[model samples]
Target: MILVSGCTGSLGDTRTNDSTDDPTTGNPTTGNPTTVDPRACEDGTVRPGRAPLRRLTRFEYNNTVRDLFGDTTDPAFSLPSEDVGNGFGNDADTLSVSSLLAEQLSTVAEGVAQRATATPDALARLAPCASNVSPEGEEACARTIVERIAPLAYRRPLAAGEADELLALYSVGRTDASFDVGIATVIEALLQSPDFLYRVEWGTSDPEHPELRRPTGDEMATRLSYLFWGTTPDEELRMAAQAGELSTKEGVRAQAERMLEDPRARKTIRFFFDNLLPISNLADLERNAEAFPTFSRQIGALMREETQRFLEHEIFEGTGTWASVLTAPYSFMNGPLAAFYGVSGVTGDEFQQVQLDTTQRLGLLTQAGLMAGTTHSNNTNPVVRGSFVLQKLMCQKIPLPMGDILERVKPPDPYSGATARERYSQHSQDEVCRTCHQYLDPVGFTFENYDAVGLFRTTENDVTIDASGSLPGTPGTVSNATELVQKLAESEEVHDCFATRWAEYGYGLTLRGEDTCTKQAITTAFKASGYNVKQLLIELTQTDAFHYISVASQE
Candidate 1:
């Protein structure tokens, strides 16, 4: 069967007219207020949106095999890389498997299963009863193995006939082969099973709203594990689901709080920030080695690591606020990075938190990695930098420039004597280019203090750089990148945008008009929590969007 059959019943449509609540005021557009809490919908009804069936991304699949089989080969690397829709590979809409991907999945599963059951010791670990089973007890031992691994592979207790189906596969393989071969067959089948690959959520009936349904406790456990740990639910979480502890919001919150303290949560945090920013792109960052003699691909990799370390520390160990993320005056750096940034005292390759030069550096925007990633190989590009700030940081949609316009205009000349700001002044010279460049170049010019490799500079080609620029909503202008980021750290729009991004990443869907109330609830709590990064994650689990599902209409 094709992978398309895996998603047969998981399709869904969002409820558009479920609530008339004003997102800002929390009052009905045509009726009186229903409650005092501003975070609720106007009718005080929980209207959840739809969540499609999500197949495991390559990252999740690798993690699953590592956890499930204790195999560290990263077999999913053989599978196709995922489409990075909506800035994340996990977006459910783009996770459909093509025939090629299906074939790869089967191939990878066979390899993983063969490796997992390669020896008698491994088979014993897979099913403890396998080590000493007699010929008479072979079927019984196979049943034992099926009962043990199927629940984990499916991520929930098997349905009535599920174990029988898996045992049937085991029987066919064991007809002439040994028990290990039979177990291998079962492993391969489990890996390719729809229930194993897809997070299939069939919501329970909600009497208060017949149209709406809440995810079952086991399904909730699956959701939490995947979001927080990026893998299958552990035995403890599964036990909690079986015990009905995951049926309540408080229980889920308790579990999320516990999960965030794990090292696995750090990886999830890194994935989110790595995708949200341009950090991961640094691996292939092209630079003119003749000009930047000290820079190399290794340095780019370290820069990516530096940002990830800072993000993990700030969210879990530091102030854990959006303010800190944008304006923290310290960053983690090893000896090489410290020397690269002209700082001293840090030694060895072990990264440690080091204070930054406040006069020149501040937080993520001024970091060398991002600064270098956004600029050109030999010179700074204000337009690209400004577009990154506008489109990514502020969530402003900068429409694509016409193809003819792109062909006619070129980047500022790096070989010129003028500073980056002066060279880029040509963008505003053309009326057609000025339309978008006016918005882009200004924000980008603020980073003129940092050069191509993000080195602090006062002059380029013997000309004093002008690093002053204006933010869109903020008044007046900021003198440099530090001031620009400081203003952004306090912006309501930026804060709400951060919340919107997390909600989208966690729920695996892009936000739409119907998601207003859900977004408002998350934003309100985020603001209430002073934008605490960890607390914002906890708030995400408590939203209606996380707890309920709106099934597809019967057309």
Candidate 2:
């Protein structure tokens, strides 16, 4: 029931070690690659493509509150747990609306709506009504609310009838209560409405081109907001839709650029990174007290603060690139985290950046936050850590192990000299276990020198922790952390993985077989534009997929 969506680790485990040659489809015996028909598009046939119902992600909900009413209350903190697809919470297919979540949403909607209506800031957001009366006052008030909140909520202006319905809701509330309470009640309804919660988009059968139907400009606004901003559309985006520019390629690009400059865009990126990494200790990391008794609650706060500072310095303050993320020698630390990282100059109660010698540490490969999340209550999981790199960075999938394979689980002797790796290596010999364990353990062995939380250590048991291992699909057999970082940082697969993750997030679904084209375009555009995050945002908003909806199949 408590589905955790945004943990930055791999869920891959090996089962039934099997690698068959890529299946040949064209001429089974000719050895020629299968070729797809080129003219199929012109033929009258249904084509495969991506479709999604846009909605607010948990992170997007939190950020939107801050922007709309300066409220950072985290509704998603306890909103019904979300399922992760393709290693993210933004996957629309994995998202579900249940009675539990519905009830929670109702409560949140009530709280947020009341807060927005009462705050002077919220009233300031509303446009001045020409006059406060029955239909006329209602029309102006509804339009103003539509113009302001709808952009961030529904991502488009409500149709005149939809506006009238909203006005009617206002009327009921006004008749029963004060005008302010009535209007707030109407806002509550919009917040709770399915239209607001689930971003519904679909295909319209084109009369002239029956083979091609697409999402309208209004639908595209939701598509763009959820994908890039991870939240509702703002006034600017809704206005763009009204002007009909958002429907065109040029308009999409312009709006994306404008949105990047808006402060809220940063929140979108931060929330995603949080979900992708799931470093819980950024708020409060649970640590083993008996082993590292020196570790205090305050150190947990400092640890995450230092990392955030490092990201700010490198990404926004300096250059945001795959390389800089791993190799930047500086990190933040106060008295406690500084002591943990083994630095001496940092004073008590103050966080400042410090450069480390490479011998002491590497990139995220040896970071405490990442290490802590992957470790157990007692030990580090190399298999889990190895899987994280493969799935999160490389974008390769690891299959889940069958239930039968796990029941045979055996733990090494508690007092034995065997290290976690030596114990893990035993699985490689088991005919059933070896196939998958082989992939995870070797990668884990490379981090042997670091304990569960990434603190450097000389040995595990009696064996020296050897931090060297080869990657599965890399050229030449290389060893050591430096080579691993180099291979991962510059990989096309890594960049492609990032592209896939972002596009899936932007479109609010898993980037799968149908999304090949959108993914490629986003990757290409991002590269051509110097890997600017903002430019990629623009590309997603303008793409054909952003404006298309699917027709329901008959049962």
Candidate 3:
């Protein structure tokens, strides 16, 4: 329910609950806060603002790929590695623009456009104009292309001359050897344009005052699509945009729900899972070969896939509560993973969750990905695992330790070694380190029974592992990975944190102090939908903040 910075926001002062700070209408003040409302503490909204204009995050590049193309290609491979501020990669303001990224984008765009033109699934949905194609026909061709892809590319249609200019580029491209090349060039240009890369907040024209501008319906649909589906608007959605059905809250809600029902809507949920469990590049993960002999590169990856299948089942196919995800008795596994997890009924490439015989295999906390990511090449870092829980799931930040983690990498004496907790406590003997590590290492020690590659282990350094730990911000102990997941599933903070993350995604940037109304609305959505990820998305995009932009930002 509370923000991680708690009171130490990177920006300015925060009023916990200011009546004037409507999350929907915004802070009634966009700039810095003046006098703090006395009512802020009781009902103060933690409205998060933009960190600063940074560069496009890796996830944004991936989402853009999935949206522009189908969910087939993965172009983030060639993109620049992200510079993370807080935890998220896509904090605009913190994001930056560079020649290197632009070059990469150019190449990616060419590849994506070529694939879009040729691929069956993608070409089937292409909106290219068969009516005209030439340097002479550039205007008509551009007009048709702009009309169809514009709503998606710019998140709104272009103005009268906008298509004309793009057509001019197409005319230039006509000098190229092929029509497909020209079209691909245009699509490539659109992807690189500031219009596509950034959240272009274009206001629509006022009917009463012809000179006034405000966002039109197509713009609203673009906002809804990116917010809910993490993609460009499909044809039906584009039709609604052209027809002016996305301007009102009711219309946005209807469209959002419809998108959720659409097969593509799952992209948003999948994105959330990907971010939460950064599995996009499993091919790169490494484990200590000798200690984790069973953890081949393939097994390292199988764990992530199992988690995905498990989540897909929980979110889309079966019960949709956070509880079911953690406490559910079932899990999916390919042959290797099933053998590792010691479960049956699961065969080859296909995965299906068969009930496990033991209660220890609760949820994500017990999962191998969570385990491996938290450990080092040959050892488990309880601090990393525990800190992840505190910072990510609980919305409580364990202050970053002052220096590099203790460089002591030697394997401990197993025959005489204490539990993982005892080994971890050695570094915290210093005063400065104890401050934060105390909070994290204790919680992380619970998964010590799982080794570097997440394979269950009876002993570490020849000593039996101890998988017992306690939660800092909660009641009861997480005796092991099983109870840890149960504790997280029941925690309101986890759900609230996830919902807030979704709100941030929906708005296409971080929700600012002015945006309490949206988070409040999101909270209502979580409660009403019984914490369904799909349902909360509809409620979020239905709000004015999802589409409405102030007049000046449009410029």
Which predicted model would earn the best lDDT? 1
Against the true structure, candidate 2 has what lDDT? 0.61
Q: Cα deviation in Å at residue 433, candidate 2?
A: 1.1
- Going through the candidates in the order shown, the clash numbers are 0, 13, 36
Off by over 4 Å in 3: 1-76, 85-88, 110-152, 175-185, 205-215, 403-416, 550-555
| Whole-model alpha-carbon lDDT for candidate 1 | 0.80
Instruction: Report, for every candidate in turn, its global Cα lDDT versus the true structure.
Output: 0.80, 0.61, 0.62
- Write model 1 residue lDDT over 1-555, tens digit each, in one string: 001101111001100112244433333344433222344466778867557788888878999989898888989878776776656678787799889988989999999889888877777878887877788988998888889889898888888998899899998888889887888999999999899889988879889878888888889999999999889999889989999898889999999999989899888888888878877878788788888888888888999999998888888889999989899999999999988888989999999999988999999889998888777557788877887776666665554444566554577556653877777785457766665666777888999898888889998778888899988767899898999999999898888878978887888766654666777789999999999999999999998889888775111
The lowest-lDDT stretch of 10 consecutive residues in candidate 1 is 1-10
* TM-score of each model, in listed order: 0.90, 0.82, 0.80
Off by over 4 Å in 1: 1-40, 131-134, 553-555
What tens digits encode model 2's per-residue C-alpha lDDT throughout 4-110?
11221224321111111122221112222322233443454444345655456677777666666566677667786566664456666667787888888888988
Q: Number of the top candidate by TM-score? A: 1
